[model samples]
Every structure is written in C-alpha cells, then in structure tokens.
Target: MGHKLRLLWAAYRKIVYVYLLLVLLPACALLYVYFHKASAELERQVAESMLRAVEQVRINVDYRLSIVLEVSDSLILNELLYDNLAEPASGYRFDQVMEQRNLASLIKSLKGHDILGIKLYVPDDKLYAREHVHFFGLSEARAQPWYGDVMARSGAAYWVSTRPQLYGAAGEVQALSLARLIRDPQRFERVIGIMEILVPETNYAPILSGAEFADDAEAMYILDRAGRIVSHSGASRIGERLLPQPQFAEMTSGRSGILRFAHRGEPYLAIYDTLQQNGWKTVSFVPARAISRPDWATSFASPLVLILSFLLLFILAAFLVFAYVTDGMVARLRQITSRLRLRGAETVGERIANRRGVILRLEQSVAHMLTTHEQLVADHYETRMKEREAQLRALQAQINPHFLYNALDTINWMALTRGASDISRMLNTLAQYFRLTLSKGRDLVTVEDELNLARAYLDIQQHRFDNFTFELELDPAVRECRIPKLTVQPLVENAVLHGIQRKEGHTGRLLVHAYASGAGYAIRVRDDGAGMPAEQAERLTSGLQGAPGPAPAGYGLYNVMERLRIYTHGRCRMQLDSAPDVGTTVTIFVDRLPER
Candidate 1:
C-alpha cells in the first residue's frame, strides 16, 4: 500500500506540470490578442477626438468672421455713411475719406469687439486712408491687389491677404485687412471706394494658440483658404508649406469638410468651413498625439496588470485543485495529459482543416441568405425611392404646368392687347411650347425633344424681348441620348428671364451646346448676360433638399438641380460657373441611355 501511494504521488506531479503548461500557452495567446485589439481601439478613439477638436475650432472661427462681415454689411447699408458720401464737397473728393471716418465710428460703437483698425482705398483717385493716416497716408491704392479686386468686382465683400502693416494709435505692424466695395443700392454702381477693416492679431492668435488636448499637444495656423502654414504655435518654420497639402483649397471652394495635415513634424487633424458672409475659410488643427495619450497609456497599463493578476489567481486555483485530487487519480490524469498533448498537436491541423470546411459551408449559407436579404432590401429600397421620385415628380408637374399655362395666358392677353396678327402668331407658338412641355405621359424624353422644347420657349421669349439672339450647337451623336424632360428649357428660361431681361444697353447671346464626355453626354446652356456671384451659384446647388418655396423672380436653377437628382439617381450632375461680367455656363452631365 505504501509503494502504491508513493507511485501516485510521482504521477500527480507530472500531470500538474503538463496541465499547467497547456493552459499557460493559450492564456498567453489570448493576452496578446487582447492587448493588440486594445491598442487599435485606442488609436481609432484618438483620431476621432482629434477630428472633433479641429471641427470645434472651425466653427468658432467661422462664427466670429460671420459676425464681422454682418457688421460690414450694416455699414454699407447705413444711412449715415450714405449721407456722408452724398455730400461730395465736404472736403472729401474721394468717398474713401468719409468711409474711413464712418468705419472708425462704427468700430467704436462695438466697443469691446476685436476690431483693430479701419481703412479705405479709392482706386480712381489712387488714395488710401487708415485710422493712423500719419503713418500710411494716401498710398497708391491702385497698386494693391485688394483695391484692384474690389474695382473688378464692383461691389462684393472679400477677405484680403495677411501681410504686416502698421495701424491704430500704437502703429504696430501686423497682419491686417478685410475689404468690400461700396455701391449705390439704386443702380448697383460702384460708389468711389472700398471699405477695409483691420483685424487684430490677438483676435486670431488666441484661436491658433490655446490649450487643445494636453501639455504636449499644440495647435498650428495655416492659410484659411489654402492650408499653407501662415504660423505655428511651435517651431520657427511659419511660412514653409506643409506636405501632402491639406485639402484647404477644396474646402475654401466649398467642396469638403474635414482635412488632415502634418505641420511642424507633428501630425494634425484639421476641420474647416467656409464663411459665406466674408468668403474667408477657417480651419482648426489639433495634434493627433494629444487625443491618444490617455487611451494609449490606459490600454497598455491596464491590460498587462489584469493579465498578470489573472495569471497569479488562476495558477493558485489550479495548484489547489491538483493538491486536493487523489494520487491514483493523478496517475490517470498524467496519461490523459500525455494523450491530450498528442491529440492537441493533431487537433490543431484537424481543427484548421475542419474549420476551413465548416467556414466554407457557413460562407455559402451566409452568401445565399445575404443574396436573398439584399434582393429583398433592394426591392424595398427601390420601391420607396420610386415612390419618393413620383411624389417629387407630382410636385414638379404641378409647378411646371402652372407656369406654362400662365406664360401662354399672358401671351394670349398681350396679343389681344396689341391687336397685332404677329402677336397672335407668337402666342400660337408659345402655346405649342407649353403643350410639348406637358408631354402626354413621359418623364424621360430624347435630347432632341428637349432641344425642340427649349427652342420653342426661346422663340416666345425672343418675341417678347424684341432683341435676344440664341445659337444652338448639337452633336449628332447625342441626339438619341435620353434626358430628363424640360431640363434644357428651364435653363434657357433662367437665362432669358434673369440674364437678359433686366439689361438695357447690350444684346444678350445665348449658346446651347451638346457634346460627348467620358461614358456620358454633356449639354451646356451659356449666356452673355448679367452673371451671378459664386456664392449664389453655391447656394443654388446645395439648397435642393426640403420644401420648395417661392423661387427668385427669374432663375429656377435649384428646381433644375432637384429634378436632375430625382431622375438620374444622382448620376447626372449640373455645374454653374459665373462671374458678374464674364457671363454664366450651366453644364449638365447625363449617362447615355441604352437604346429602347
């Protein structure tokens, strides 16, 4: 009996040793995976936090600039400024002097606001006046780009470049200037000068230089428009350009939202927004390191400490269990452990092969389920999308038909009012145009049909105007291409109604061109009429969602964009490029439809 007990004791030791090693291997593997995953999760959280910080900066800067620009608008519309300018002989031959005086008074009214100084530039007289005229007196304003641009735009507000200049009582040299043309409200003619506001460095510097994430993290300044580093909180390289240039230009052009950049050897995430009021782009950059520091430290320390504690507790429990078990049972367990080791080696390969087979079958089953589910989802979505499209079409139909009917009725009334046979003929043509626009039951029509409809609309408009010429250039290849019905006509109507109708001295030229683009067809309607500003074009493109309200008197650009989005499932695109005197181009891109 003593010999058997001794044999069991030896057997038990072997069993415990093998069992502990087997459990330890898997525990170690699990620990590795847990830590790796934790690190990855920490990185993602950090990146997101950095993004949020930058966005906050963008919001704050844009908000401040918008307020300043609103103030500038009020100054332009102010009766006092107008009254002062109207009295031309009050020792102010140039309106710039009066603007500077009035701007100074306006700045004082906003007592605690961050306005550093006010200045004015008169291009025709080549004169400029700031608050501290003793230092920068009557400079050649024509040579400055700000003055040139203001003259070129006639009456538009713009944020000028940042350059060092002296102003105010202290005569401190600093980055300064915001300029806008002063124009007569009645005729919209330029009234002698451009108003310039000097922005205080303190107002902008604090935005660039605040505690962002932690002690180690810093914020940097880049050109609000181009993302070029104008200043950095750290490092001497302020003017040097950042690499992988952040999409600052695109943001300024109003294309995208978040941007990332590496400035001063530190990675930064940037959030940017365009200021509609002043045309200035504001961006906030925050270091990526700041966001991840807490998470990274916690991820490393907590996991290692948890795994060690768990290992110690598990080892103690395992030893106690082995101690309590009988010696004879321990011998059996040793044999079992030896068999398990052999089985485990084989099981690894077997499990891998079996897992592959199981995974293959699982994947096939999942694929079949997904296919059925996707088809069902697609059908449901397609049905809903179609219903929405139909509702939009119904709404659009109500508007277009009403507009055409009113236009025709007006033409008929005009013919009777004039008692002219020519007017009667014009009314007949106009009626036919309206009839074509109200096509029997078709939403998608041939490009040829659209062109014919547009020509008819133009014919009526030309007759009404007595002096409008239109040219049509159609590519024969695109004649069979299908397009949303009434697309071309509305664009042409916009041109005639908004562009040419209001201008008195010049004859308007309307050009319609159709051409082939990559994998699609493009149709452009162009007009040499009073073109819209960039801001107006941006609003028209972006403001398509929600309720359709009263449109501007002449152009229904938004309506056209909405109709295109609905019909083409966003495949079709419309682009409008315009300048005040350079005229406007409205281009439409549509996929070439398969032959019916």
Candidate 2:
C-alpha cells in the first residue's frame, strides 16, 4: 500500500504539469484570436457608420444644388426674359425696362427663401443688371469668362464664379453663378443676351454642414470644375484648390466614391461623388482614426473574463478529477497491469474489453460535432448569397425609363415647333426607342428581340439623318441567345449622333453583327464615322461597368451589364475597341440560351 501511494503521487504531479502546459498555450492563442477579430469588427463598424453619415451629406448637397439649378432654369426660360431679348434694341428699349422690372418682381417671388441675387447680361450693349440695376459696361462684361462661355455654348446653361461686379457689393465674392444664352424665338438661331444668377454660399453651407455622424466624424465638401472648393463645412477652405498635387489630381480625374487620403497630417476616409451634368465633384471626409478606433477594453474584456472563468472552472475540474477518478482509477489500472505482466497476457485482453463501452460513447460525440459544423458552414454561405441577390434587385428597380422618355418628348415638341425637323425627328426616335424599352416586362430578353428593337431605333434615326446608313448581320444560330433588354440601342445611337453627325462630308456606316463563339454568343456594333479617342473610350466603358448608380451614357448598357453578371454568374464578356477618326466597336458575349 505504501509503494502504491508513492507511485500515485509521482504520476499525479507529472500529469498536472503536462496538462497545465497544454492548456496554457491554447488559452493564449485563443486570447490573441479573440482580440484580433474584435479589432477587425470594430474597424468595419466604424467604416460603415462613416459611409452612412457621408451618404446623408451627399444627398443633402444634391438636393440643394438641384434647387439652385431648377431656379436657374426657371429664370433663364422665363417668357418675360425671352420677350425682352427678342425685340430690337431701339424701339423695344423701354419695353425691355418694363420687362426687366417684371422679371425682378418674379425673381423676388422665386427668391422667397433661396436665391441671394439675380443678374442679366446683354452682349450687344455690354450691359449687365443685378436686382434691377445696370452694373457693367459692354466692354467690361465681354471681358468676363462667364460671358465668353455663355456665348461659346450658344444656349446651354453653365455654372460660373460670382465676382464683385455681378453679385451685390455686400454679397459673398465666392458665389455660384448660372448663365445661359437668351435666344430669339423667331429665328431660333441668334443669341440675344445672357442670363445669370448669383447664388450665395450661405445657402449651400447648411448642406455641407448638416452631415451628421458620431461626434468623432467630419463633414464633406465639393470641388468646382477647376478643383477649387465650392462648398465646405470649413469656411476658410472654400475657394482653395484641394487637388493641387499630381497624386490628388490623378485621383480626382474621373474617379468617384469612397477613397482614403491624408490631409494636414491626419488620415481621412473620403466619399466622392461626381456630378455628370455639371462636371462638379462632392467629397466628404472623416478622420481615419475616428472611423477605425476601437474600444478594445470594452469590446474584448467580457469575452476574456468568460475565458478566464472557464479556465478557473477547468482548473477546479482537473483538481476534482485528480482527487476522485484519477487517484482511484490510475491506481487500480496500474495494479491490474502489473498483475497481467507477472501472470499472463490473457488477463490484459479481458481488461481492454471492459473499456470498449467508454470508447464507443466518445466516438458518437465526435460524429455529432462534425455534423453541426457542416450545417453551420452551409447556412453562412446561403445567407451571403441571398444578401448579394437582394442588392442586385434593388439596383435594377432604380432604372426609371419614364423620366427619360418624358424629357425626350419635351425636347421633341420644342424642336418641332421651332422647325428644326432633324432635331425633332431625332427626339421622336429616342422617345419611341425608350417606349419599347419600358414595354419589355422581363429584365432579360433574347438577342433577337434586342436586335429588332435596335433596328426599329435605327430606322427612325436613318429618317432623321437622311445620309447615315447602317446594316445588321446576325447568325441565325445565335439569334435566340439571351441578353438584357435594350442593351444595344444606346451604343448605336451614340455612334450615329456623336460619331457620324460630327464628321465631314461623307456617308456614315454602322455595322452590327452577332455570331456564336464557344458556349456563348458574341454581338458586335461597329461604326465608320469619327471614332472616339482611346482615353474617352476607356472612360465610357469604365463608367458603364463600374459606377454604382445609372451612368449618364444610358441606363440600358449599365442595366444590361449588371443583369448579365447576375444571370451568367460573372461569365459574360463585354469589350470596347476604338480609334480616333477611324471608328468604334462594342462587343458583348453571353451564354447561349438552352434549347426550348
């Protein structure tokens, strides 16, 4: 008995030391993984919060700028302004004064809560008026860049800087101006004068400042076409150029959305949005530290405390096992082993048979754990796929063909009344094109159906252009190949209008062909007009494929690419090739539809 007790003590001491060493390493490794995961989770949460806050700021800024543009459009297209510009300068001079007074009253009415000041520029007299008073001489007005740009564009509205001459003496020097040419209705060919509006920075400050986030977050700003700050929460930074360095300049050129940059020695997360209509950019910034900071002690301390408690329980359990099961079982087991060795090998076999029941129970427990792990993995993957599908559907829902159709109809009617038959016919064709576009009930349509729609569009365009010609060559085998609806029409239209119309005296040729390639079908549209430069073509493709929302090129191509990606599981192919003055070709390839 004394020898057995001494042997048990020595064995127990060695087992306890080994167990502690084994448990300690795992416990430390677990601690490291726990903290590392917690830090990563913290960073993701911060980035998401910052993105949401900056997005809200972007919405507010867009709303404000939209209001400004709307007001500017209303003033430029005002009947009184148009009537005043129409009449000859000699007999209609007094009439112009009365009209100007009425316009001033209208401006005051429209200015109820938003506008800071209004101005009108007459190129002939070099005369300019703001809030009912003539301010600049003809020579002085002509010298201004805003006047030159308004003349250069002929009639389209443009945004400009509000200097002291046009804006009120008390008004802010750095204000936004909207200018458009006032054309005569009779001829519809002459520019009579320019109309301008000076919008105060204070009106936009609220938009820049109202961006809300956690206390640690910062607001965003907008850079004008020249890269000068137009709107910002920080007043001092307004009008200063932010992208003076080559790196920032490169970053700003045609790039949009969330980016990281260091400013004034602090790292910041910036969300940038470029306004396609105005060539202006809005950027919001939050401190990187603010976005990535984690309360490590708070987030990880609870888990660590639980782990420590678990270790305590494990230690107590080990001690209990040592006192109860180990002390008794190991002693008995050793005695049995010694007896078997001294006597015969048959006793050893009998002892091993008795332990089979315990080993069987352990096997069942391990199998159950494996089954649970596999189920968890499958559930995670299913959840992720569903989330991605939902996002794609949401994006598809936002493409509104109705608004585009309405805008086209308006342009068509305006052109018809003005006797610009070519422009009117083009607008009508565009309207008909989109009408069919909205009619396709399904998001996906056959390649044959899409090509027929493109042909209908081209027929109308051909009537409008008179000299432009096009041909289609489709492989009968691939005609029924599935593709997104209205995909090819816009590219064809771009080729006709931008490529063909701008070229010198020569017949324009547009060729569209489709054929089978491997397991997919390839559709190509090539034009023999003034082809785009390589850089411009790159920009067009990048914008179509990469932008988050509807790109300005046309919602059709963007929608098509997105749908193809979803349907083909990223197997669809899109390519663009073009050379200046040669031509442009756009190709799309997708999986062939299964036979009916």
Question: Which predicted model would earn the best TM-score?
Answer: 2
- Clashes, model 2: 2
Q: Per-prediction TM-score, please?
A: 0.45, 0.47
**Candidate 1 — which residues are off by over 4 angstroms?**
1-22, 43-53, 79-112, 123-139, 183-191, 207-211, 220-222, 229-268, 271-287, 317-596
Clashes of each: 0, 2
- Write down the TM-score for model 2: 0.47
Clashing pairs in 1: none
> What TM-score does model 1 achieve against the real structure?
0.45
lDDT of 2 by residue, 39-155 (tens): 555555455444444444544555565666667665654566665556655445566567666656776766635566666555454222332353332344576777777778877
> Each candidate's lDDT (Cα)?
0.62, 0.65
| Lowest-sum lDDT 10-residue window in model 2 | 352-361
